[model samples]
Target: MKHTIFYILFLATLSICNAQSELVKIEADTTNIRIGEQFEIKISVGETENVIIPKLSKLNGLEVIDSLKTDTLKNTISKKYILTGFDSGAFYVPKQQIFIKNQVYETDSLLINVATVKIDTTKVKKFPIKGIKGEPYQFDDYKNIVLIALLLISIVLTTLYFALKRSKDDQVKTFVPKLAPYQEALRNLKLLDAKLLWQNNKIKPYYSELTTIVRNYIERELHVPALEQTTNQIIESLFDFSDAKVIETERDTIKKLKRLFEQADLVKFAKAKPLAEDITSDRKIAEYIINNMQPILEEENSEVSYSTPVVIVQKPVIEKPNTLAKVVLILVTAAVILILSIGLGKVISMSKTSKNQMENVQ
Candidate 1:
């Protein structure tokens, strides 16, 4: 019985020594500071095994500026943190728990005092305000020079206009017609296919160009600003527009386009690798959408009987006048008026001066 009791005591002492071998300590640089002043907290761990650091991104009343790395020695590791507080008050840095080898160890909480700068009312003083200064104005300061410059510019422009008018017949007339939106989109898709962008591993640029062509077509054909809209935003705007009009039939096409844009976004942003089948599917969808959305050509309207089953009535299209020509005409007329006004004003001033001289001589 005596031998057994001594053996038990020896085991208890050994266990206590083993537990005390490892130590964890936390130390701070200071305990008090003015508000927004920074201080350091050093955490030291002895006999470090597998250890997990606590997340210290934000404290209740304190802000973490930087967390320094653990300095490793033979059997110990030390970590340093810089923290600050913006409010003036007493605050507690919460206890940090560390996990190691299925066991938990925690640091004791720390208390810190933050104070604001003190101000004294006895040291304040008052001063009188200064008077404002004024600048004298001149009536004809640089006005004559500016008017003369305007007159000269108008004369030069008038001379150039007549010269260009006379030489207009010698210029070649290049009448390049604008391509319809559908034609432009189809041509671009053909060019894209020839390049085989996806096969060449240029997926992002390929999708970007593809989406741009589709957006431009939407803007030109439907007057939608698809280029500047996100996928979700474009869908929402289209749905709103459709509710007001009879455009429910185009919902399927919009959904297909949305899927294509999302897939492209994944490839461009999320680094997704698409299958060959997927690329072919997208191409087919694009082609189908463009073909279906092409502008319909109408033949001349003929008189039809009232008993006809289906009589498709086409609305007459009105063409707008050339806006550029109107703008140029307005600018030319304004310039001519300005020149004539200046000339008349100068003549009236000269006549007044001569009349005054004649009166003085008499």
Candidate 2:
């Protein structure tokens, strides 16, 4: 009795289900999708009411790019799902199962063919930036380092050169002597004292000494050449010297030396036969020039002056004169001797004179 009851319940449930649902359909326009191609899908109900068409909750291969809804004859909503996909291979639309009153319906995937595109090399895509296009090594980097090194070396060398130059400059400037003129002229004159020009009978040398004394005086004092000028020229040039603070006597002595120079030149070149007195005058003139220039020389050479050598002349000594008085005195002595020797005069005088003649005159 229980089994018969179970069979009746099952048959009644099957008859009710058959009456409620005639069919559930699901379909699509395409199944294959290119990278960017789109396609559509549809789900429909026939002879169905008071029932829900299950939502397509999942899909594969064919992406549901968009979905749409429509009201149909049975007051049912049909879903039109449009899809687009971007993959190379034949992708699939997942089987979408629909549930109506807890019953299941599934959709079939229709294929949409998508062709592989031909690449155009002529229209090749360009990268915004190309990577470094050069040799494997970077020369500029090393070059910059080398240039910097050279610059440093040059700077160091230039600094060293200037420093060395400055050091040498200081040495020379500080070490150089600042000698005064007078002392130098005096020292130079002393040098000439040792080489006596007159003692050697060297006439040219004597003139040189005279000239040198005057020249050195001028050089150390007024800084001019007394030796080089003629008397008239010197006299004319004296105005220039006098313009300086040199004493009047110094000028007069310079003029005297100028005259002496003329005399010497005449004696040397013009063969002027100068008397002893004229020569003596020359020496006196040279002495005067020396004395006159002494103050300037001393002033110039508070230290020593920077000038050439000085020349010195010394006059020869003279014998004393046998004057008339001496001659007379000798005559009286001779007369007295003659009287005393009159007795032995011939004998003594003849003997003495003969002996003196033979020994000294011979």
Index of the highest-TM-score prediction: 1
Q: TM per model?
A: 0.35, 0.29
lDDT of 2 by residue, 1-362 (tens): 99999999999988765644346556667655557777777777653555565545544544667767665765555768787766566655556665566676555545555556678998998767444333333566357545655665566556445433323222211233434554545555566556765556556666666667666666656655556766577666666656665444555565676678777777667766666566667776665566665433354545653544344433334334347645655565565445544634554566566666655543
lDDT of each: 0.74, 0.59
TM-score of 1: 0.35
lDDT of 1 by residue, 97-139 (tens): 7666667766767898999988887897967764443323344
Candidate 2 lDDT: 0.59
Name the 10 consecutive residues with the lowest summed lDDT in model 1.
301-310
Off by over 4 Å in 1: 1-22, 124-160, 163-362
